[model samples]
Target: MARSTTDSSSSGSSSSSSSSSSSSSSSSSGSSSSSGCHFHYVIGDKIDKYVITKYLCSGTFGMVLEVIDEQGIPYAVKVIRLIFRS
Candidate 1:
């Protein structure tokens, strides 16, 4: 039997029905033609913690940083600049 290549939807415990694409990614893009897609989204908004410590680098893109959370755990956040146009 041949493996099917269709996106299957799933739901989280929160009753949220977001997408978890099976092959939209170049990681496995075959069926559909991608004009060009960029995946970027708000990060810390989901956490409600952490503080950005210092600006690490910014280029044609936006910014990066060294951050510390409420638990004193350090992390790096890369906030992209312009919205990607496909």
Candidate 2:
């Protein structure tokens, strides 16, 4: 897969530099764990080659995010949280 670098500053937030890979893998800007697992992804977060643009919505199971590819093509991705029993 191809990799690309993006300017996080475009999202209007100041953060450390990060790179993105061209793959279908899932990622997040950050995450937090409480009763279950919650993933927090912000705008400009590069997951694969797509940059998160807007947060569509979230449910008890997961969330839908609006992202755009390097070519400016928009797409929606669903992030699901898995619960593990020990």
Candidate 3:
């Protein structure tokens, strides 16, 4: 699996709490997909308290991501794509 990182702005003290809260909510809802077809995750993206640290390799079924928890423990997460047939 390949690894990479994207650029993101540093959060300010005032916006930190709000952004964290929003990130938590959105992560739980799993509504990251903007096109409704696939999820494009970038470095620094938060998913259910886990922050994406790398862009791992992808396969036909889905893609793998390297994420870290609040404690700084790393983990690999596979995000499966859903295909609907007519």
Candidate 4:
């Protein structure tokens, strides 16, 4: 079995996500390819009362997506990677 982990810390009003992965295959490329794919949200998916609209962008930390509320007002929602740290 393989697993991945993440750690997050808050500095004042800012936060960060660190990704760690291990797999059956020893290939580093295999681990890198799976990073940031933890999120299950997609277009038309509803979460936190917001409906996912589009995938804006992504970084090593997380991804940002466009979402809309019931009122149709759009907003930028940041969905970070899963954090496994205690």
Candidate 5:
């Protein structure tokens, strides 16, 4: 991510020299938001790229997808209930 550097020494404050604090902030006046499936516990694409390895189980009952978690850990994802449908 590209960042714009601004001089804040003119204010004469103790935090004027904090580099790390200013880098992550947006200097421009803009709006930012995330578009994801808000209903589900699944964090969507932003949660460290959870790769769907396979299904743990599947039948007329429901389905369970085995996935690699954020830390590359394995987990069983079973659809216990239908929270929302569309």
Candidate 6:
């Protein structure tokens, strides 16, 4: 699996040496979001080097699919569902 990084720092905060209290809250929210799915990729879609083949199952949080790599090696891919604020 590949990893992505998110920087929580804002542009205005970098100008001054004094850090804002919201910075900590922003970072915490960023970390929480990191655990959730950021994209809704479908079957036959290629993520990185893995190609989604078939859906295996689904749960409250996400769905699991069968996938393969360029070498045809099989793998199980879990895609997380996005939660929208109402």
At residue 74, what lDDT does model 1 achieve? 53
Collision pairs in model 2: none
Tens-digit lDDT string for candidate 3 (1-86):
23323322122232333333332323222333532426765578786667876654446766555566677656556676778899
Best by lDDT: 2
Tell me each candidate's TM-score: 0.38, 0.54, 0.55, 0.53, 0.33, 0.48
Query: Looking at candidate 2, what is the lDDT of residue 84?
Result: 79
Q: After superposition, how far is residue 53 of candidate 3 from its true place, in Å?
A: 0.3
Regions of candidate 2 where Cα sits further than 4 Å from its true position: 1-37
Clash counts per candidate, in order, are 0, 0, 0, 0, 0, 0
lDDT of 2 by residue, 1-86 (tens): 12322222132212211222232334444355531336666568777778887655456876555667788755555566766779
Per-residue error for 78 in candidate 1, Å, reads: 0.4
Error of 4 at 70 (Å): 0.5
Q: What lDDT score belongs to each candidate, Candidate 1 first?
A: 0.33, 0.52, 0.51, 0.46, 0.32, 0.46
The weakest ten consecutive residues by lDDT in model 1 span 1-10
lDDT score of model 5? 0.32
Give per-residue lDDT, candidate 1, residue 85.
69
Clash pairs detected, candidate 3: none
Candidate 4 C-alpha lDDT tens digits along 1-86: 01111222121121211111121112212122454646664468776556656555557777655556577655555557765797
Better of 1 and 5 by lDDT: 1
The digit string of per-residue lDDT tens for model 1 on 1-86 reads 11111121111121111121232222211111221213232323333455434333334554433445576545544444436468
